[model samples]
Target: MTGIAAPGTKVAVTGAAGFIGSHLVEALLGRGCEVVGIDRRSLRSQTLARLHLGDVLDHPRFSWVEGDLTDLNLNEVVDGCMYVFHLAAVPGVRSSWTGFEDYIASNVVATERLLRACREAGTPKLVFASSSSVYGMVDTLSAENDVAMPVSPYGVTKLAGEQICLAYAKRPDSRLSVTALRYFTVYGPRQRPDMAIARILAAALTGEQYTIFGDGTERREFTYVDDVVEATIAAAGVDVPAAVINIGGGSSVSMIDVIGLAREVTGNPVPLTAVPAQPGDVRATAANLSMARLLLGYQPRTDLRTGMTRHAGWMRGLTPHLLRTYAPPPMITGPKEATCSH
Candidate 1:
């Protein structure tokens, strides 16, 4: 029940077609593990077009189930699985302000249901993908002990999701050992088109203007996707009783600086359009990774310039039309100026 599930052991990953989930699925398959990838989007879905998992999907050790987490038959998915990595949740902070109910359903209610199902199925361990936004605007590098005061509904629901896992762990008869990883801003190739890095790179490549809210001073501890995947896999295998760990890139960079790095990396000067700061947006985020290192032996390998360079390369390989098709609508800056980037 502890230590990395042995090779050939079935592991279930929700959101398997997502940016991070797809990468995790590939890593698990490479480790000689049997994987069940559960995702709401099918292989044909436009959202998954960038995933590029033809070989992994064809592998004998990988199976996929497309269904909603809220109504999916968890018994069937969790049956005989050694570990469950729950990465399926509605994402985006700006969108959550108006779509709070969807966030609750996906992040909070679905998490509760998944935990209950894991308990019933006798699943031993679960690694939930929590967010660093749960810490809001921290004065120092955020730690697990800090009182969680999420400023946005997205962060609030992620905090609730973590609490649900902890609540289940506290049950007298429960066998589930939950490890919630509070991930800082995860970015790399295949990052959601809505994220800052993705949008910045796309704009740079396509000659489109990229919007920057908050005067380009906002900073984030941008963890690479591969690093997050490593920590997540380590968390699933480690014999931790029940813990919340911070998984971050270990370096904080300002938004304007990131754009400079992107220009240096891609050799494409990205046009910038600055707008008023959006609501629920924090000014800075830096993760205290002492716990992640101590607990999961996690250390981020990719630095900001290197990660951004890789992301730029990946974006360059994509068809121009796909980039335009998947580009997320401009983020809401404020009520006065509903939209900015075009």
Candidate 2:
């Protein structure tokens, strides 16, 4: 309650302990709104524990509800909230390869449940966290109305979530003014370590040999966490009708270039070992953000080089944790070394 205003609008943030969600919580607090944060995992370390505990320590206004959105009493949490940022889910394309049912439950079914609850509570607006993976290596850059061809179950679930939100919008009693922000390769501080650029760069910075899947040729637009968060906030503030906007970094760059940039920033000469491209991986993704520009006034400000520099700097600050997967450094030798080993 301390973070939320006494009489101010209440904003509920799902996945509050997550990278983007935590930052969004801080931003909402900065804006003088009361924040109700919910997350599924308990903190394993003191630092992370404080992220959830310190700001709202014994505060009357801030509320911490520890539960899963799929199982929670949604009405109890969202009852009076003016805005809801649905950021919770089992994330990662590789992750879905093993546990598709988890993705279905968390990303699809859970989202539907939340929408239903929003309808019941007469909630005004919701900002959904979606992925640009829905584009799936399209022949042209994805537009707002393109047929979403999700290559991965994870992407499928996210698209399904958006469709579910849209379906709810069509309902007579559905008062939820929802918007979906299709985020393109978000990176920055607190990035999930499994993500491509961050995970590899993190290992390289720390003198660990990181693995690169496939040749570092696939191009992607890596959006910074701040830019993505800003776009989400912009979507929340705007009156756009059932909008779906692309939030990418200003431009696209190849994985090879990103590796080079990370090496320049970290000054660490970690070795590289190329692996096969994981299933569900897209060759390239470029967002046609004209709709976002016209609707949310969202212009991705960070470029790949700047974003990687910032990401390397952030990873350098963290005390290295044991990464679940092994990573190799960027290969500068030749394109042959960088090609898929599989």
Candidate 3:
């Protein structure tokens, strides 16, 4: 159960075209892994050129499967793989309330299908990209053993996916070693256009109004993307039968403070619009990372300011067309880890 993605290690990643997924693919490739990726989105060459994964297209060991998870020939995507990272899902909290069916299909059904594929392929390690949304509103730092009382349909679906993983891991006939990391507000360069930090940064560039849902006091444990990716890869190698770990950003901050940091990092002021908080939006989220430290040897390396500085640099590198993809959000942001399935 201890494999650190050595040279020529065969790995499979779902949602390879997404923000976090793309980063994971690159990290695996850097480790000399032979990677097979599957995503529902068709990655055109030109579009790929505009995103984080353009160079991966030409790598000798990299291949991609472009199709929905439920319909794809999953054995092609997963067979012979030593590790399978399941990161694909329809993200966002409010949207899930309006489009619960899509959430169920992608997060729940698609996950079940991937689990079955891994079971049949006899994949050694399955790392599931879960979320803090599964915790819902918490009065203190949420830990792995806390009762899951998700307040959003999206959270419910994510919880269902984690439950399914736990069930499969406990099954008598299963050979899967499961590690589900509950990511708390993952952010950095290449964040989805819909996420809070992405919008907050984009608003600085576009001069558009960045909506602040609720007062600006809503706090989130914003773990950097690189930190999350490392924790995930580490989990794949860690010796554990089945475990859930929290990947936190190392610190917590309010939305207002984040906005201020964005302005400081970019040196550009963004107009802010305050609005009443919508349903399913938690007042705050924090993580107790004792398990992460002990289980995966995880410590969040990037703080908000440094991570935001890198994010600003990334945004500055994008062309106007590329920047268009980082369009201002209609609302402020979604749940923590309102990501993946990019």
Candidate 4:
């Protein structure tokens, strides 16, 4: 695969301040594409905050726009940009149960708005950041072809967003070549504070007790952030009309193994608490990435242990609050607690 973009290929990335979004921006910059990043959150991650203050956005080839995806001026951002990487959304399956409206607006309505704007603007290609949670709870070995019975409102909204992309791409005179990359458990440096393995293991490293919901049996294919970014960039450059491809690390690991890895990575034996599983919690998820392999020439090179260690190392330098290890409140018994347990 050609890892470099030709000159003058401006790329627009939504959710640019986010974990996945920031990585995508960095990747696009490395590939020599002039980038325009749009996001609402500012100074969330310290690394990102450093990048923010470093005037990276002020580069001759880089620009930053601060706004919600649904409310942004799409034409201005989309102008002169041939590739759009849509990663902005209300995240977490459990959060959707209590806040369905946010999910609807951010995940579904925002995507629809973007698709409409792209259609109107004649953008040539768009790569959507989708979630594997659309599969929800399923039998072991969940594949792309399996029925997508999303158990969470977030999943439903994401699935709806993918449908919107495909439907928009199918327009008779559409200039868009849309591809939805369903990511599974993305983790690495700058992982969100609420993510599962990172939170659990990072807490252990800081001498904090962590809660393990659902007896640690739930399994997931935790793709590294870098791999997901690679796949996203690949999908964006592809000429495929409309495709749904799984972006995963291609291996399933249980919560127990994640805790074990955390212990190993942290070199600390932390206290643990067991809680009942919350709503929208899945039993297991494993992506069959054959479609992505054939279409995007994608390969996941980072294993969970290695990725977790990298996150742990990065977390060590940040404040304990970012790791959720700094004197956190009692275990949250609410439904939203289990939403991000990848």
Q: Tens-digit lDDT track for model 2 on 168-200?
A: 877766678888889888887667655667666
**Across residues 1-342, which tens digit of lDDT does each residue of candidate 1 receive?**
124656897899998888889899998998888999987777775545335466587899998898888999898889998899999988877667786788899999889988999999999999999998888777788989999998877889999999999999888888999999998989888887778888888777777788888788788889988898888999987676589999999888899999898789878888887877776788888889999888887789999888988888887777767678435345446532221110
TM-score of each: 0.94, 0.88, 0.95, 0.93
lDDT of 4 at 225: 88
What is the C-alpha local distance difference test score of candidate 4? 0.79
By how many angstroms RMSD does model 3 differ from the true structure?
A: 2.7
Clashes of 4: 1
- Candidate 4 Cα outliers beyond 4 Å, as residue runs: 43-55, 319-329
Q: Per-residue lDDT for 135-250 in model 4, tens only? A: 97777766677888888888898899999999999988887889888899888877766777666766686666677778888888899988888888778767778988888998
Per-residue accuracy of model 3 over 206-279 as CA lDDT, tens digit each: 89887777888988889889998999899897676788988898777898899999999988997888877777
What is the Å distance of residue 238 in model 1 from its true position? 2.7
lDDT of 3 at 256: 88
Comparison by TM-score, 1 against 4, better one = 1
Go through the candidates in order and give the clash count of each.
0, 13, 1, 1
Clashes of 3: 1
Query: In angstroms, how far off is 127's CA in candidate 1?
Result: 0.3
* Model 2: lDDT to the true structure: 0.74
Winner on TM-score (3 vs 4): 3
